[model samples]
Target: MSLKKLETLSTKLLLKNPYWEYKLDNYTLPGGQTGEYHYVHTPGAAMVIPVHDDGTLVLVKQFRYLWKKESMEFACGGVKDGDFLSTAKNELSEEAQLAARDLRQVGEFNPFNGATDEICRVYLATGLSKATRERDASEEFEVLRMSVAEFEDLAGKGTIWDGMTLAGWMLARRSVSALLKEKRL
Candidate 1:
């Protein structure tokens, strides 16, 4: 089945953030009903699955204002104008202070599916090298390196609860395992 778009109505800001805006859309359902949807108009973002050569994953713990607590998550940030890869690299360096020799796309996700129109491109950062820390002003992250088994134990025991972090770990572990089995790791 496919979803077909009917009509779109957008509101453009003439002042302050001229580029940032909202778009309201209308769609025709399969049963011939019209539905309206509102989405926050904005550019997408990126997240990283930082993994070491030994198949260990790197994650960060930081305070999330919305959740009012620290969350353990993969390195993530917004993609600036015309610089997706650089945004990923900058986010990794800022959050974890590590550069990867092999940075490749793992997957992508819609962080806010209901109202926002932002797609977070997920990547796997491997072969980490020497890099100095330069975290964002609003960010304070504590880094951790753990094996897949350790991560499984933590997740199973309810010790690690961050969804994004868990997803990154799971995907990276699967990829690493497949690569190792095929002599590609």
Candidate 2:
């Protein structure tokens, strides 16, 4: 096995439009070999772990076009032209119709490894209260509240899918336990 050095990376537009764009690139490898590839990239996004004081989590049930089915997933949405925290908060409200007083960054994840560039920021949201859910016209999702035990059960039972959501839940589970302990004292 050998390590590769990127001598150069040049980007070219394969498909250009206002809605979306596709790009092509050529990179020089370590052995002086140039490789060409095409990529379809999109802006980064954010996901939220909306937890209640009682160790409950807010999940959304929506139709995933890629999977061609509905899945029980955590609150997540695209990062618009705003701060990451604002994106998380907005997603919590829009997707779950809930808000939290205490919000913290859990972690970030990159789902694709081959060509596409997609980064999703995950956040932990607690101290939840009811709020208005102003969903976008394209957004048709339903919110559900479940206990942490239920989530754990779902995870074990193979119900809670979505790798990003699972990763965020794992981190938030530990953090929220400590947070709850601190609140108790």
Candidate 3:
């Protein structure tokens, strides 16, 4: 069976944001059922796994207000328009005050498929340096570095709980290894 969208009965914008919009839409489903679907319309996002030459990974401690808890995650932010790479670079510097000497896209995934259209593009960044850290007035996060091994242990023990972080990590570990091999490290 092929699903088809006959038409959107109505589209009501619930919330407007720089990176995404929350909207409630009414439409006809594939099986001729008319229903309402509320989802996030977004320009998507970017996540960076910053690693040093010695295999140290950069992580951040930030309070996610929605969850009302501190979470450990890779530096990440939303893409602008359709410029994902530039957004990744800016997020790396803005969130961690570091720039990547070598950066490459490792993976991409939909953060929430059922309710949102936001896709997170993951990148592996190496050969890093310190830059100016700029935080928004509402943003507060602590940056920390740890050995890759320690990160693995923490993640394995369910300590690093952010889904996006794990997704980024899954893509980055293999790439980071290849990067180290190319550097003959």
- What TM-score would candidate 1 get against the native? 0.79
The global C-alpha lDDT for each of the candidates, from Candidate 1 onward, is 0.74, 0.80, 0.87
List ranges where model 3 is wrong by over 4 Å: 1-10, 183-185
Off by over 4 Å in 1: 1-4, 12-36, 156-158, 167-173, 180-185
Model 1 root mean square deviation, Cα atoms: 3.5
Question: How many clashing pairs does model 2 include?
Answer: 0
lDDT of 2: 0.80
Residue range with the least summed lDDT across 10 consecutive positions in model 2: 16-25
Residue 114 deviation, candidate 3, in Å? 0.8
Residues 1-185 of candidate 1 have per-residue lDDT tens digits of 86665644434433335334576666666667777776676667778877776777787888889979877777887776856788889888888889999899877767658867777778888789858767668778898888767778878886788766666555566676775566553
Candidate 3: 10-residue stretch with minimal lDDT:
1-10
Question: Which digits, one per residue and each the tens of the lDDT, describe model 3 over residues 18-47?
Answer: 767999999986677898899998898999
Sort the candidates on TM-score, descending order.
3, 2, 1
RMSD of each: 3.5, 2.5, 2.2
How do the predictions measure up, each by TM-score? 0.79, 0.87, 0.88
